[model samples]
Target: MALMDGRDQQHRPVALVTGASRSAGIAASVVLTLAQAGWDVGFTYWTPYDERMPWGADPEAVTQLSSQAVGHGARTAAIEVDLSDPHGAAGIFETVERELGPVSALVLAHCESVNSGLLDTSIESFDRHFAVNTRASWLLIREYAQRFLGAHGTGRIVSLTSDATVGNLPYGASKGALDRITLAAARELAHLGVTANAIDPGPTDTGWMTAEIKDAVLRSTPLGRLGRPQDCANLVAFLCSPGGGWINGQLLHSDGGIS
Candidate 1:
């Protein structure tokens, strides 16, 4: 693994994106978008999570995604780790910094989502959700804020959130906690000049939605279509850019007015 030289490193800011285990996911889209936007990209993925899901893990996702980013002329690093471990955040940052450089942007797109209702959700399931979605996110933000050496007003933190809580109790509840943790950073890390915000990309069909679910979403959504990973990626890339500096401390909905 070769590090970027001083000149190249200085010009292209590094963005660390989580949850890019599969090519179809939003994190993969964010990585490609940021790469095209002139940012060196480092991303994380946990294969076990995907294997447990209905859509099994794609073994070559990281390699293929890295190749795509390199084609866009961006330096890239892909780390595979379980975010449930309490100490995972520090190791992730250490590896990315050593591989690329100091990260200017942190994108939290990783999640452990299993659909269980309030009545049937187990204690272990609930805890795991919080562990990956809430606790891990807080730790990641803390690590980013502490180690951030970017120019003032250039640091960015963007977290993906959801509002679906009816049948998906644990996933939604943990995401709610994540939203607060991320928004708090916008104010708490103000002195560091870091802008933190959460996004709710409603009803995105990242291989989880069934045909019936897709039709229901389309009928309710005025656009009559499902949200795409690229839509959310576009917003993330903008938020990391200098132009999105002013929008902070708020949960923005980029779900095509699906609220």
Candidate 2:
């Protein structure tokens, strides 16, 4: 949830982006894009997860990201939290609201992806993926909608999605679950004034892509290039905007047709 109902204590909208640990990743772009679009932003990062990735993150990247948002003339908050925790959503919403304001839009962009096929995946890893990518997302959306119910307003919910993981079985399956949860939430929460959808960013180079993988992806994409973080960011920004209110319960493809 980009923690928000309408405006904050200072009468500004606040956006909370998850998984913003990497300078080059989608979370960083989401935070900056929302800031540029004129919303005060709050974001989250997990250092342990970042450290485990092949393209490990700079511990200071969150600090740098928040500062950059500040330069965009929007107030910013950065929280270090683990979405894998069962009760993570409550703390996240509370902290974001306390620091920024009530969240009106929830962008569930955080994911835990270990590149393992079905045979290579372990019980531990599969559970980890489910905890972060699917369970946490459902909890966050639930919390966001509940916050809106108390505050008496509307909200936007846009989750990042993918299906092109040929080998990462858990990642693909969990993300598919995310998409289902989002659509179901959209229907269930419509009466409460919330819209929900997901985006397939498709083969984007968010630091994990190698030279060979990128070349192969380029060959497959009709657009003939790998997606940039900003590509997803722009679509997300639009979905959260008032103009996008009519669009609901959709799984959007923003990957330049990689499907």
Candidate 3:
């Protein structure tokens, strides 16, 4: 059975995005795009550790994201969430209800730490990776399904994954798990009207990418360019909209044609 209460399903839909900081982050960009497209939004951020680090998460970043969304004519809310913990997943939904009304669309774009290469990875790293990247995502979707169900009932879940899932170390393996989980859930949720899909942003111009690395990635991509947050956001917005109802349980590569 679908998880949504019948009464809540009848209302206008709103979207909640995790890890919405920085104009270049995928979650922030998705919220902005969704707002511009007329969807109400709720997003979260992590507290920053330092004042000047350009790449770290900041709770206040959501304010800018929300402001931009609202400016686009969509009601918006921001929250502080530590998505690495399984328990925190439920709280995110609560924030959605308290701040933005009922949530019909969910975007899981936030993650804990980024790592690469097998030799550099550790067991602790493996657990940490799954905790934030795979397990938390699964739990969030579980809660979303348990709470929202039905066709025309309103529910869309788009998660951010990585190309590394195809072949790599902890990071790639973790996202591979997420992909399998999402695809299975999509199949189960489809009957009830919800859709689940994964997207890989493909080396976008975020804080983590050094200029030299960005240049290398751009050159590698078939399109001869690195991804933009908006590129991923555009696909996410469409998935959340009524028009994307047919595309479910799929892994979309928004990576500018990079493998």
Candidate 4:
């Protein structure tokens, strides 16, 4: 743990970030960035999701991320929960409030992504994708809205979205639903002064890209490089900040301008 800067820990705002199981993932970057930006952090991770993916789970991810947050003078809490359960969101909020404080920002980065096209996508897989990506997100936002006690204009919700439907039916369709749910919060939660927005970070290379994919992305993108986790993290931090309070109810493409 790092030395405290004499500021009251109780006064610092807390941010709850979802889908932070991988150390190299965007959620982890968001956690670190928020911590450095002076927001105490709480994040959720489900190792089973990562374990099934090509890049296996890192058992120490939570520990390492928590240590890094504390090193930046931020209080940290990490939980492993399967978001597929309808009741999971409420438990997450309860744990976060108990361990940290009322959440000021909620970053929905958790996703169930398995590649299958319209023809091959199974009914079970489609349902699971919607369960984690769409239903869970809506439930989490509802939990956040109900429990939010922060001052008006201090509440934030940012969800990560994508637009790759071809050969990826369930993931893409669920994400489309997610965008609407997140945007709805912006209008519905207006009385609470919370701002909600979704970000479509096109083709971020979080160790899932092959050399061919990398080459194609670089060639298509004007910036001529793959999107890094930090790129999305920076945007998330800003939206959680006082400066980004005005940006709400929109889906932003934070990709490196890939065409």
Which candidate leads the pack in lDDT? 1
Give lDDT tens digits, candidate 1, residues 1-259.
2233222445888999999999999999999999989999999999999998999989988888888888777889888899999999999999899988899999999999999998999999999999999999999999999999977899999999999899999999999999999889999999999999999999887899899999899999998889999999999999999999999998999998889
Residue 202 of model 1 has an lDDT of 95
Q: What is the C-alpha lDDT of each candidate?
A: 0.92, 0.84, 0.74, 0.91
| Candidate 3 vs. true structure, TM-score | 0.87
Task: Answer with 2 or 3, whichever has the higher lDDT.
Answer: 2
TM-score of each: 0.97, 0.93, 0.87, 0.96
Q: Which residue pairs in candidate 4 have backbone atoms (N, alpha carbon, C) closer than 3 angstroms, thus clashing?
A: none
Per-residue lDDT over 26-142 for candidate 2, one digit per residue giving the tens place of the 0 to 100 score: 989998899888788888888889788888868778777877887777777777888889888989889888877788788888899988896889999999999999999999998
Clashing residue pairs in all predictions, respectively, total 0, 9, 2, 0
lDDT of 4 at 191: 98
lDDT of 4 by residue, 1-259 (tens): 1122213465679999999999989999999999989999889999999999998988887888888888887888888899999989888988888888899999999999999998999999999999999999999999999999999999999999999899999999999999999999999999999999999989988988889999999999999889999999999999999999999999999998883
lDDT preference between candidates 3 and 4, better one:
4
Which window of 10 residues has the lowest lDDT sum in candidate 1?
Answer: 1-10
Which RMSD values do the candidates have, in order? Answer: 1.9, 3.2, 5.2, 2.4
Say which prediction, candidate 1 or candidate 3, comes out ahead on TM-score: 1
